[model samples]
Target: MTVIAFLGAIGPLVFIHELGHYFAGRLFGIKSDVFSIGFGREITGWTDRRGTRWKIAWLPLGGYVKFAGDMNAVGEPDAAWLALPAADRARTFQAKPLWQRAIVVAAGPVVNLALAVLILAGFAYGYGVDRTPAIVDSVIAGGPGAAAGLRQGDRILSIDGRSIDSFSELARFAQIRPAEQVAVTINRGGHRFVRPLTIGVERQRDRFGNEYRIGRIGIASGSPVLAPVGLLEAPIAGVRMTGGIIRGTFDTLGQVISGRRSIEELGGPIRIAKISGEQLSLGWAAFVWLVAMLSINLGFINLLPVPMLDGGHLFFYAIEAVRRRPLEPRVQEWAFRGGLAAVLALMLVVTFNDLGAVGLWQRLAGLIG
Candidate 1:
């Protein structure tokens, strides 16, 4: 059941991502040769009236759409496409105007992001957010909040001049700004005052032994309040949530790059599968949320300015726009090769981290001993 649930979660995302490219190509009058939901040997397939071969392949990890006039999934132009008649060449992806090609390439990531927003909006409208007011129920003795003269029943109005809508917001703000002194505004008995509190920092480890630092103010909040979202406001809330996730992802990546965060925090397919199975066990709502988060991750990752990614293609297009011509094929080929190598290296590292997190190596060593 777990395996099934994992597939159920990943398959649709891959399909939708490829579908975005396919639809965008068709919209620009470009022909598609294949729309595959996986790599390697085909498990099942059917050809459509548009001469597009839609197929399910053996590997279920990722998918691609092969456009006409392309040699492969990487969007390399084919020599045979150049040899084609003018009428047919006009229908090829590479033969399209630069703007059209750019749109077709960018459509995949855009659709993934849009899908996340739509899913989140639907969830918000159906089941309102579980929120807690930014009111302190208790402050730990001798902790940062207590030391700063905070007391029970104090309503937190803002932190560092940023207005706090809920306790979760306050906690998130603190978590990311560990060991920093922040100006917090609280309303006590109809009077508001600012308090300078240096947030305490704590290093926490998860079940996997992955450690990260978080800020602590030693404040507790009351029970959650169900804040109902109206249909009209749901989409706006969804966009806001998606933007927050994207910002958080970049911040974490920046931290990892800057040595503030451990590289072991990175995870690959194994971690995704484990998370999906756990979310499935939790309930439908949790699984849906996982899907939404994964969609955002996918979209953001593809937009990274690395070769062999949509962002890479966009980067090249920008150069073409400025220079008024595409880069030489050889240059593009070498760049893509380097990008592929980098991607493979990153994947291996993340996979190793995932295995370590699950204690696979430790279990293997135990068995051998």
Candidate 2:
């Protein structure tokens, strides 16, 4: 089930991302080499009448669109188009205006944002988000909140003085908060009790690096109340949710860089898979939330300024815009190599952590002992 959901969620999402680049390239009159759905060797594919080789690669993890002149950028041959005259080179990606190139580069991540909005709007239209009260569930034993004396049936009023009139508000605060002391207000029975919580670092890992965080009480959100507004309002709410998530992601990154956090707190595909598995076991409502949350993550990560990513390409475009031409091919080549190395290192690290998250590490430790 997890496998199914993960593939269903990622495949269409990636197709949309690559389609953005492909369509934008066409709009700018840039020739595309291929429109691929996955990486590595082709599985099933057909070349378009325009000579673009559309194929699904063996690796199902990610996809990309190759542009003409991409081969030349790396000093490779145009063997596939050897029949074309040298005069036709203007159709290559390099021949496009700097602004057009920038637009093409920027479209990939923009499509991701659009997909997230659409998905969220779908959920909002069919099953609108309820303004659920921030009701407390059970606390994990020995966890930070338990250590702070939080109990069941407590209705949280605020966190660090941020008013939490709804579960969404509470979560809005929680999403960005790392390991830090926080003040809380909860209505216990009929009386409101204020308490302070000092969160200890909880570490996680991803395909990039370790990350750390902190949170107060464990929570099982009460159902959202019908906050019914209007039919046209769902899209607005979806876009707002995407923006809020992006802001929170940036805030978390800032916290991590400031040494208030650690890298071991990151969670990658393995963690997500587990969560997806568990969520499926529960019900569709949980699954929908997971999709929305993961959509936000996808949108944010693609926009990160790492080389080989959409944002990185956009960054290069910005440079070209100022300089009036692309950077030296050699410079772009070296940058891409370094970016690939970084991505690989992060992937290996996260994979190891993923195995450990499934108790592979601890079981090995016990065996050695």
Candidate 3:
């Protein structure tokens, strides 16, 4: 069931990402030689009328679209193919303008982002969001809220100058910044005032014995309400939600890079499979929500400025646009090799983390002892 769930969730995303590149190439009249659903040995395939060999390969990790006049899936120009007649060259990816090539390389990640936004928008339009005012009914004695002079009937207006509409939003903001001081804006008798509030922290452990630190302000909710969003507002809400996720991801990565967070928090395919199966057991809603979040992550990761990635291709294109020529072939090749090494190292680290998460390393150590 776990295997099936993982495949079901990941397969379509890979296909869609490759399809984006294929369509973009077609749009510019560039012909594709192969459209593969995976890398390596072909399990099965068929040639279309346009002579593109569509195939499913043995590995299900990732896929690619191989365009004409290219050396391989990486889209480097093949010397022999480049030497073909002008008529043939005109229909190849390498024959296109730098701007066109940039668009083709960028289309994959953009489609993933669009897919995430549409999924979130559909959920908003179909079910709507829960809404409640950030009104304080009571404050816990000796807690952060009481220490900050928060009292009953005071309405929380914002946190750190960012306006919040509901108690849920306020909680979310505070939860991420445990032990940090933030400016709390409150509305009392229609007049607003800001106060410096140090959020109280609590240590929590999950069923898996994973510990987490969360913030508390010690305020109780007054009332709760469900708000139905209009059709026109749903897409806007989706975009806003996507933007927030992106920003949060950046923040987390920044912390990890700065040594303020542990890199063990990262996971790979094994972790994704476990989570996908868990979400499937919960219900389709939870599963699809996971998909939407993963889609956003997929899009964001692909846009990072690293070689052997779509973003790397775009980076080269940007340099080409500036210099009026592409980099030397040998230099580009070495950069791609370095990029591949970096990507593989990251995969190894994440896989090790995933194994540790599942207690595999501990079990192995027990046997060794």
Per-candidate TM-scores read 0.88, 0.76, 0.90
By the TM-score metric, which is better: model 1 or model 2?
1
Better of 1 and 2 by lDDT: 1
Write down the RMSD of all candidates, one decimal each.
Answer: 2.9, 6.1, 2.5
Q: Per-residue lDDT for 1-369 in model 1, tens only? A: 567777988899989988899999989899999999988999999999999999999988899999989888877777788899999999998899999999998899999999999999998788887578999998999999998999998999998888888998888878876777889999999999999999999899855455678989999998888789999999988898788779778877887898866798799988898878878877899899999999999889988989888989999999999999999988998999999999999999999998986789989999999
Q: Write the per-residue lDDT of candidate 2 for residues 1-369, one digit (tens) a residue.
A: 778766666677778888988999999887888888888888999988888989998877778888887763222224455455665676777666777877887787788788778777777777776678788766778876787778888888887776777777676666457467898888999998889887555456653343434454455565558676466998997887677667777777787678665555466777777777767666777776777777667767777777777777777878877887778867887888887798888888777878876788889999999
After superposition, candidate 3 runs with Cα above 4 Å error: 77-80, 141-143, 154-158, 161-163, 190-192, 200-216
The 10-residue segment with the lowest total lDDT in model 3: 205-214
2 against 3, candidate with superior TM-score = 3
lDDT at residue 97 of model 3 (Cα atoms)? 96
Error of 3 at 182 (Å): 3.4
For candidate 2, the TM-score is: 0.76
Score each candidate by Cα lDDT: 0.89, 0.74, 0.86
Off by over 4 Å in 1: 130-133, 147-163, 176-215
lDDT of 2 at 98: 75
Model 3's lDDT to the true fold?
0.86
Q: Candidate 3, residues 183-218: lDDT per residue as tens digits?
A: 999999999889899999988986446567788998
Top candidate (lDDT): 1
In candidate 2, which residue ranges exceed 4 Å CA deviation? 72-87, 129-167, 175-179, 182-214, 217-225
Scored by TM-score, the top model is 3
